[model samples]
Target chain A: MSDIKILQFAPFESFVSPTFWHKLAELKLDYDRLSDTKRSIFGYYTNRKASGCLLEVDYSAYNSEAQVPKFSHVAHGNIYNKNTIEEFKALDKTALLADEGKQLLDDMRSGRALSDASLLTRFFVLSFADLKCHSYYYWFAFPCPLTPALELLSPATKLKEIPNNGNYVEAISVLPAHAQNFFILHVNEQEKVCEALSLTAALSDFDEERAQHYIYCFADPSEYENPAWLMRNYVALLLQKCPTLIGKSLKFLGLRYDQQMHLDNSLIWEVRQAEACNYEHVQFVGWEANRNGKMGPRMANMRDSMDPAKLAENSV
Target chain B: MHIPNESKFRETGVLTPEEFVAAGDHLVHHCPTWQWAAGDESKTKTYLPKDKQFLITRNVACYRRCKQMEYVGEETLVEEESGDGGWVETHQLNDDGTSQLDDKICELTLDESKDEMFTIENGKRSPLRVVTTDDDNEDDDEAIDMDTFEESGMLELVDPAVATTTRKQDIETNPSNLASVVNASETTNSADSVLRTRTYDLHITYDKYYQTPRLWVVGYDEQRKPLTVEQMYEDVSQDHAKKTVTMESHPHLPGPNMASVHPCRHADIMKKIIQTVEEGGGQLGVHLYLIIFLKFVQTVIPTIEYDFTQNFNMS
Candidate 1:
């Protein structure tokens, strides 16, 4: 490969229809945050192979193909939201997928062709009942938990029902430098504030600066184990990926924070599973969606005569 | 099957103007539709579809607001005090040129013959770029790599496309592989095997309205934790709309041909909204007014049968 100075570098964010989970990462995602055309859900390439910190957007919840999302294929399985794949199937029964699903699976395992969900959906109607699968990972976007924000509030965590912008489920903060600094400062402030108000300090003659540093440094508590402190490091790692955001990611990160967020205090975020990494392969078995080594009762009734085209096991 | 009453408020219960505004503030940050708004307090309103107006009265400001707690993470660079020298922290540089694959995929366009397909010959999985040296010089060397993928169990997308070459004999002299004519539809095999990845999406949206402007309940966290008003604000502003909008979902609001009930038929939408509000330290209220909305809607159209499923699933 010829070497050219990379003028600008950025990490791209892609949200694909669960129907686009072709072999992990082989998706078609648009680079623009908001485009005139519909977001072409690109299959994900495993982070292992693609390398780098990944901002995963998992729509397995929509996999039921019955759970209608307000838009796109995310509404798949929804009693309401209509999807392109569903519309296509409804329009034509003998489409490419209807006849080719079984064969597609056969070649994928053999490493001949990559696997995709749209190609698989043609194996008759899909109901989670027909397949077996499990969650590999998840992201949570939530509100940034802060104590000051709670002052004039209720006691129940579920008191309020919805969150605003800053509130996210799960955000991976990655700015380690800032995180580390904040941690130290926060610890120092805690100690200093305590010492400042302590009546005991009047007699002990505590040195304000030294006392402040003690809680932060290893001056006291020889066996200090702080999980919250450790969690800070993870947040730092997530923040480190801030520059790579695109699409909804900008909404997830690039947005400014008026103040710092504390731990377990925000909305959970969308999660991405390592599909190929976990080696999870899902296929339909007689009107039921099935995964590796597991099966569920087909949602199809006997009178309907449901048969998901099956390829030879271990064919691909 | 529909009514267009933008000014219809307090059609049922007797909520004071303050309570109504406070409730709007809660839903603006807690409701999904309320997340996108423009302008500030005094006139906070969520931009939404004209039909879904029931959100206005959905909020029932509880006497008690939720509590919020959090674990503080790291801040910035640490300052040494023991007369120790200042130390520098290391950071991995952003992704670079070789990392972006625009030219790679674009060049794979079809020519005349279909034989010459697109394929990555080598370096498909580039090494993850990291910078450990505290030195300021070589910091711009980080590239997106596939290092931590194994542990997270999310590594499976980095494969080089390998195209098969086809030999051809043409009218001119020697034959060559082409991109055109290659059966875009025809498969070398009878068909292609498809692999579907299971996706799990947890959407936490805060539709906010800053009525009673001074304070408002945040929202219910998906993890069952409490979110604060500030946190709720942070979550909402993170979106493109960037405004404080009120929710108006009701049992039955006015809209197109006999639309379904707001809280019942659109159960997931409401559940997500309540969960968002609960996560934000906002109080969850019963949609008693939904029944009122239905009664009123029924009075307008006597034949409309209300299908109520008692919307549960809120925190």
Candidate 2:
């Protein structure tokens, strides 16, 4: 089994109840320490709506042209600020998409020619805390190049009706919109583990020396058991406290650690959606075995995942 | 001699061992003997008693008054006066500033003799030589070369008392010379005159991980012998020596062994030099690397003097 694990979550951004802060305090988390303002809330997205994510375009699994920057601050600095997010959102649908966004669409349409920088930037910008906190979910529908041979089933088919498949791996990135820190979580379905790694940098000055640094693994074994289950509960509780995440579109991110590639070129997957159902558990529909959409590999899987043990064993 | 405080030489310029030797030679030539000591064993000698000893003496010729009582024959003069009248005595004082009587002497005719002295007087106000016979002999028709003969009789000498007095006179004139010899030997053994200096051999290598030049102290000296651990304590400054001794490791050798090291500021200086060179697209060679290393090491090991210009077999 791979030593590292990853888990992905669709973030819900809203004003969390004061009781949630009290709960966070009980968990030894200082919620007030997240931001400078007292008005700030726990605005990060937890993976409550998504049943599980699938392994997509693992750079480690392929010999492809890839690069992952040592410092993520460079990408963070290039992204537009809060004011520009609105302007981009207000643009017409036919407007020229960003170079990265266009590259993402092109790669998804043809599961080949993946550009590392475009994928990283697309996912990073779409899940930006500023945009997610404002209930903007259009960017969440990020283009991903996953063409796995999944079984064909009707859209209305119950998630439990699908047969079991072997375990899969996925790359994920989770950001709390109200906080400066972010995480890249790699999910290993077979092991049922999530390797949560933290990436932090100074936001005020992107080029600050020692600005972007990474803590390889932030999750202790004790704290990270059944990572998918923990993520589900955390997200559910977060949404209950901050209801704004409901009906809000959010882009979820995935990451695959690559020794040879830079952070920008490393495998990154993005999925976009607005929570549309009241189901307590998250669900995902894989690309059917019919080779629907000519997807390369399934990047995410939605299934009945309210059960903690089943979620780890199920195809995601 | 005492080693100068290293702080005094902080920021002073540095040179290779060769350059150091050249400069040292210059200083030795210009300064008095007491100011600097040679670092090389071959260049210096231990001041010893035998080397400092020298000869001191005075030569004196004495003449006695003579009066003939009767003439017996054409070639002989019979003297009625006794006590060796009409004779001269010449005495040579010994190395110990003393003289002995009852010694054989050489006699010759005034015209035939090569003796340069006319008269010898032992006194405070006058030198022993009174006149020279060269002028008188130059005009004399009777001047003739004669074989000198040694004799123990029929020779007139100056007052007997003067002979003993002349020995004292020689001693008085030369007391300081003897005193100096004794002084030299005393100073050589005295603690006040101990020679103190510090020296080291430097080796430089490129550190791949740190991406900087690393300098290693391969050896150091205590009075020209490879220094022992105890002597190192005496040479280096107290605080630095303590730190250095603890952190030292053989930079170039493989073993569980350590040697004294100087760790302060070597990297900072090298980094700055590299940055400057990179800006100009300059490359560095072994010689240039050593030059830069020496220039900076002086600031750290200020108390220990070095001659950087000395040739090193880098290969």
At residue B96, candidate 2 shows an lDDT of 32
Question: What TM-score does candidate 1 get on C-alpha atoms?
Answer: 0.20
Residues forming the 10-long window of minimal summed lDDT in candidate 2 chain A: A295-304
Scored by TM against the true chain B, the candidates give 0.16, 0.29
Per-residue lDDT of candidate 1, residues B26-80 (tens digit): 5444433232221111122233222221232111212110110000112211222
Pick the TM-score winner: 1
Query: After best superposition, candidate 1 residue B287: deviation in angstroms?
Result: 11
Q: Estimate each model's TM-score.
A: 0.20, 0.17
Docking class for candidate 1: incorrect
Residues B1-315 of candidate 2: C-alpha lDDT, one tens digit per residue: 222223211132223333323333343343212012111121122321121111111011112111111111232233223422322112122223333321211112221123232111121212211112122332122112100111112122111111011112224433332112111001111111112222444433333233233444432221122332323333343345445433343333221123444444454565556556656776433235444555665444443334344332222
lDDT of 1 by residue, A1-316 (tens): 2431111111221222222221111111222222212222211212111112112223223121222212111111111111232232233212322233335434334423211222211122221111112111111111111111001112212102324211221211332211211111112333333221111222134344443232121001001111111121112222222212111111011111111233322211121111111112322112111111111111111111111221111011
Assess each prediction's global lDDT (C-alpha) against the native.
Answer: 0.21, 0.25
